[model samples]
Target: MATETFLASFGLVGLRLIERHGIDPAHFARELGIPSTALPDARTRLPSALLDSAFEKAARCIPDPAFALGAAECWHPSHLGTLGYAWLSSGSLRTALKRMARYTKTLGQRMSSRCVETPEGLQFIYDHGRGDTLTGWVMADFGLSLIVSLCRTNDGTDLAPALVTLRRPTPATIRPYEDFFGGPVRFGETHDGLLLSWQVADRPLPTSNRELATTCDAILASELATLQNDDLESRCRAHLLHELTSGEPSDTRLAESLGLSTRTLQRKLAALGLSYRGLLEKTRYELALRYLDDPKKSVTEITFLLGFSEQSAFTRAFKRWNGKAPSDYRQSPGS
Candidate 1:
């Protein structure tokens, strides 16, 4: 239930970009209010806010907004160390994605990957339910990098995708999308998804390091198990409720406010058999019912309070959940 830290995975990528761009990584880290020495360990789980700010700065410093994505293309197996190397050694792109989805907590537990087969190709959807600008960008860059890495590991550049889709509309950083994708790139989509040919997914990777894969899996499983048993579930729920009302909630700030490690908080929620999404829905549902019963609260106020994108969506969801329209439920009498 800890607020999803979707951008945490990009800590290393951001640091690498700083170094590649002739900027002092340490200086950049210091500017972000983190220890300069932490750059090497940036791959480890981190507070979502710090990671977001770090990547945002990197995007600004680099000549191209897609610098991180491009850099990830040439990232050596050794650069990612055990985790990255293990993924590279997987049998196929599908297996690698499954590995990443399972151990994503090591990088960013807040986001999850879903793989689907389409007639066009294999689509890997990177779904991030929370976080801010930096977090969002990191997810985009990382997804691209992972694909690039998979291609390299297979020793086939032809396996690259025909298009990459992002949820964020074209912004000043849009140039990077064209440069990194080297193909059609679409913006302003409903969600973040990558489009690759099924043929590439069918190709086998050259290296399959079973020992490395096992070790990485074990490490990730341990972390996940720990997170699943912690008390951070309730705390995350409270944070979600606050965010729903405020529009902007910082996962790092929430963790600090609760005086708990972000990883620990995430682990606790997993142990509770719940997720941030689950808690958010529960919170919204309870609030909707409460407001529906209060004749003094207008539908617009209720919609705004519940952080709904529009009144219609809220109305539809309420009907689905309660088997009655909001107005009808409010008008029902029990006398």
Candidate 2:
């Protein structure tokens, strides 16, 4: 089985910040086991360990232990591609967050986000199992800062979290976090997340473009369907695993990857009582449980990895397949 990977984009943002401070990104990447050439593509799927390694190396070179906070200061919706557009046009911060939690896989495949409502307000959680290394600390900061920054943008005003929580211990001085988030910071929590007042989520986005959001949704939906409509079962599985790991899942791409005519491919699968759709369903079910077993991937991430259009789609399918939701299966004393 392949070791799980993460979107290198999050770290790439930090690398640029390091270089902006006068250090060469290539040299930094080399110190972290990534070729400088390999560092440019934000969408590249790298061993999650490489990001952790790079973050640690970056800490030794940069003066600030909390450089991740600074890097997030440069974040913009455009950095996220379609996911960003979907957010920009969302009807409200709450709706935008729903979109973010749903499609975060497009930004970081192994990263999972959850948004829940509480009496206190809205809580957004960013969870990645990067351990206690400097990379882990930076990633936690980066994730927290990114979302809070987003919340600020969504409201078109300066804002802060009601409470910021980190799984790691408090840094030597909690001032950086408190200063950056403009709120109280709490460490040694079981998870990494930040909270916002309920009002922040309920307000409408001035830039909300429902038509564009719908268009992006359609495009994403088409991509998901394409993954399930492709060539021979054996070749389809090979192509799905290889390209879908980092690229969009498309039937034309799969056929090209297998060097088969689309018609010819259809005939081949039919030879074995297989349909592309059937193969996709079986393959997704097979891979879903496997990916979920890893603490590194949240249920949301596994849904996208398995080519389901949405997390709910994966859950419904899982229920049909095993008579229980994925969470129920995984959380059981024995999966």
Q: What lDDT score goes with residue 146 in model 2?
A: 77
Which residue pairs collide, candidate 2?
none
Report the C-alpha lDDT of model 1 over 1-335, residue by residue, as the tens digit: 56544223345555666687688877877888766444354234556666556666676666655556756644555444445765765656656765665555555555567777779887877765444465576557765666565665554464556677877657676666665566787877766777777666656566654455555655554455454434456456556666787753555666677786777666766887876567677667756754554556789888888888788988997887767878886654310
Q: Tell me how far candidate 1 lies from the true structure as C-alpha RMSD in angstroms.
A: 16.1
How big is the positional error of residue 101 in model 1, measured in Å on the Cα after superposition? 1.8
- Write down the lDDT of every candidate, Cα atoms only: 0.62, 0.69
Task: Summarize candidate 2's per-residue lDDT along 1-335 as a digit string, tens digits.
Answer: 34556555555676777877788887877777776533345345677667667677777777877777876666555466567677777666776776677556556545778888899987888876666656777788877777777777767888877898998787788888888999888888988888877777767668766667766655544433333243245458766765655634776776677788777777877898987667666666656644654556789888777766688988998999768998897664323
Which candidate number would show the highest lDDT if scored against the true structure? 2
Using TM-score, give the best candidate's number.
2
TM-scores, all models, native as reference: 0.59, 0.62
The C-alpha RMSD of each candidate to the native structure, in angstroms, is 16.1, 12.3
Clashing pairs in 1: 227-267, 227-268, 228-267, 228-270, 228-271, 230-268
